[model samples]
Target: MISTVPHNVRGVAASCPQCTSSLGRIWHPDMRIPRGWALAAGLFYLLALAGPFVQISIFGRLQRADIATGPLQLTVQGFDLVGFLVLAVTIIFPGIKLGIVLLTLFGIRLEHQPTRFLKAIFRWYPLIGPWAMVDVYLLGFLVAYTRLTAMATVHLDLSLFALVGLMISMAALDGSLDTGAIWDALDTGPAPRPIDADHRGGHLIGCHCCFLINRAEPGMACTRCDTVLRDRKPDSIVRSWAFVIAAMALYIPANLYPVMLITQLARTTPFTIMGGIVELFAAGLWPLGLLVLLASIAIPLVKLLSMACMLIEAQRPSGRHLLGLTRTYRFVAFIGRWSMIDVFMVSILVALVRFGQFANVQASTGAACFAGVVVITMFAVESFDPRLMWDGAREAAPETPPDPTLIAEPA
Candidate 1:
């Protein structure tokens, strides 16, 4: 029989004996607070998008842009992929995530059975939460604003303040959200299936997507969410290696090529990633320059190297430092996307600074390659399975040799 047992003293984790997988966390009872935060954030998000976000005055001409301006400008500039990425992360996913939170909270209040659609929405909450990058986008805006101030008189608008508030509210909502508590509130059915002691074949599999623990063969659909089940992520090592290697290859050209082309007074100048940072430092913006260096140059390299190490360790039989490796994998996954700050900065600049031949910002080939590196590294991190590290250790454990004293008596 499957039973819930605290995996930590703080009650943060519970393990399923059947699949040996973490089921959910045990959170405090104040889970309803995030619902209010989500609602406030949703309102702030609408306001942020509706008005002028930032105003720039170049040579006595004023230009204003809203939140949608970046993506639209990028698409018009022929960088459709990057445009869609910014839109999805900054606008689309945040709205969907906040709406889901509101809907799930409201659904709990209804004195009726929860529908499958509602359950599905709640299931996707954790998956979609990380992709909502408003906070990261705000950081990108800061970098862009710093750069713009050096060239033009930049004015922060009401929408900018609203966007800041929106980011803060979303952060608060995420902080207050209790995943385990939310799952418990949404579950209105029988307990998860237990692993039968007498069952044949392999161990019980847990659905990473839906948190359903069940006894089933690989490639079967999850009974609860219908997601295909796997003992581990399919071809985890191979896929991660492929993405990591590709990212590493792209990293070369991404750094060597100019990321942005600045046209000032009818003269064009190209700036590579480090070149931009050096220019920022030369202009006395040491802090922002340091930020860009860390986000653009350091973070990606660390992610690639760290992921490679984890993958190598996972594939080996050595039982050394499995816990540390698991923690490293989690950290790599969390920080992989922050490297997009430079990309977002480029987008904002391209959108705001356009005074044809007098002052303009254009994305260079390096921007596209760097974006590819960031995205591919993120996929590599996601494609990896931390559980494989532990599984390797378990499989590598030396079996206890048959006790000589307890050897069976001769029949």
Candidate 2:
């Protein structure tokens, strides 16, 4: 009776009171509406890329910064890794996502749908969706705007407006998307998979691309989406441990070193992550200061701790609060990217504030280390599959454990 439905709820959060599994989407959205929203988002995305994002003036010195300018400045300052990270998330990934959406939807609408081609492009739609972080970038811009206004005159530009529009459109498109329905449309034929021949017999393997359940071996291709299937993610435990350990090593330098160096009137001051948060509070902006503290400091610590706990639990599967642990994993995975707020803020400041010692901002080594921690943690989460937690619990009490997959209908 295990339900294999994907847990992506939109309407009122309804779950089976008995087992606590999410009830799938309460209401399906019109497919056409999503296309329109995607189109609008794509247009705004183009506009946002074309014009100046913001302008700043300090002591009669003016600097104009566009979306790409921050990443360019970071590279110029020798933070190539951080620069490439920002550029991929803010610009390249977003464009790729939009293109995937438009092409898939258009292909689906064709008289003779190109199922294989559509499936190939759409497979990446969800995988890359989270990395397209336009909304997070806007929040980073807000923090940067506050800092800029405190020191000099700042002007919002057309590109900023376009970015705002793009964010809204992307939000709407995501809200209205029915991934289940799209998968259904693309799956016009039965999954083409090999028959299980092992003595133990193959277990139910979920396709990572389409979420279609298939009974197959670890390395078999999914019948529906053709994605390689595995009993669990390959080397999930070991990879997670490696990433977590590396991130822990970087966490020390990320905290100890200065993330940004500011020069004012021939005097330079270095700001660690904590120092920036303190400055915001000193300026009587405790709300924003609190946000920076949570996003940059508290969240990363919690994520690391939670991940460690989950890794331990996976080793010795138990029945105690397994659901809570799974929920924690999801929360950590979702908020991990928000930690990039400080990195983005540093990039913006570097791009906008340059006055040759009178007033200037430069990214430092700490920024690069912190970015590594964030990106590495995200990879750790991705590498560690949550289902391993449930599988562990099931193994501990095979008869007593209620199937976690049995609560809702499969999408």
What TM-score does each of the candidates earn? 0.88, 0.92
**Which stretches of candidate 1 lie above 4 Å from their native place?**
1-25, 192-202, 210-212, 399-411
For candidate 2, what is the TM-score? 0.92
Per-candidate Cα lDDT values, in order, are 0.81, 0.86
Winning model by TM-score: 2
lDDT of 2 by residue, 72-179 (tens): 999999999899999999999999999999998778888899998888888899789889999889988988988899888999999999999999999999888877
Q: lDDT of candidate 2 vs native? A: 0.86
lDDT of 2 at 330: 76
